[model samples]
Target: MKFTLVIRQGKTQLIGQLKEIPGVLTQGLTIAEVKENIQDALALYLEDMREDDAEDSNAIIAQEEVEFA
Candidate 1:
């Protein structure tokens, strides 16, 4: 998948994040490094999301009784 990165040139490093995904950010010494880091960060982000989804599925109540008093 291709993601747009919003890159910023900082004083000592390059900072970037996926434009569509929040919390997926990273920094590097150069633009190239920043791009690579962004890929890694995005992958980790997706992995975390998958894990979270799995956890949520596990917590689902298969059967529930609605009692109204």
Candidate 2:
């Protein structure tokens, strides 16, 4: 899976955020570092989403249905 990175050049560092995922942001001293940090942030973001889903009372794990023709 691929995600877009919106990076901004700051005075002291480069700030970046994943365009598709909200709240996944990081800062680094260089573009290379920012890219690495973004990967970490994306991983953490998805992991957090999974955790949140597990914690939700209304989350659906699976469903079965009969096929009719």
Candidate 3:
């Protein structure tokens, strides 16, 4: 699967983020490096998500209500 990559100029390095996946972000010194880093970051993110789903399947889910200040 392919997703859009967004790179931004940072002070010391380039920052890259996956457009389709929030919180999947990383930084590298060069464009090539950042591109590579983002790929690894995305892979890790997907793996983590899959693990979470597996755990959720065995979890006893519940809801709670409380006032937020």
Candidate 4:
């Protein structure tokens, strides 16, 4: 249920996207707004996927760390 959110300022607005989910993006006038918008979008996307019985290959979130010698 957790996904990486990438936020950036566009020419005239704040843009956001879910790095884990391809093609899932949103934009707003502010960072907070963008975050909220992306959250809503993600929720709707997941809802639709569930309604359609679509399988999510990347449902689980994971992280890895590396050590330098």
Q: Across residues 1-69, which tens digit of lDDT does each residue of candidate 3 receive?
A: 567899999999999998988699999999999999998998898799778877887674764555645
User: Mind giving the per-residue lDDT tens digits that candidate 4 earns over 1-69?
Assistant: 467899988999988999989678999998889888998898898788666653553654653555545
Worst 10 residues of 4 by lDDT: 54-63
* TM-score, candidate number 2: 0.76
lDDT of each: 0.86, 0.86, 0.87, 0.81
lDDT at 36, model 1: 90
TM-score of 1: 0.75
Pitting candidate 1 against candidate 3, the one with the higher lDDT is 3
Candidate 1 residue spans exceeding 4 A from truth: 58-69
Q: Per-residue lDDT of 8-48 in model 2, one digit per residue for the tens?
A: 99888999998987699999998899999999988898798
Q: Which regions of candidate 4 fall more than 4 Å away from where they truly are?
A: 54-69
Question: Model 3 residue 49 lDDT?
Answer: 79
Weakest ten-residue segment in model 3 by summed lDDT: 60-69
- Tell me how far the alpha carbon of residue 16 in candidate 1 is from the true structure, in angstroms, after superposition: 0.8
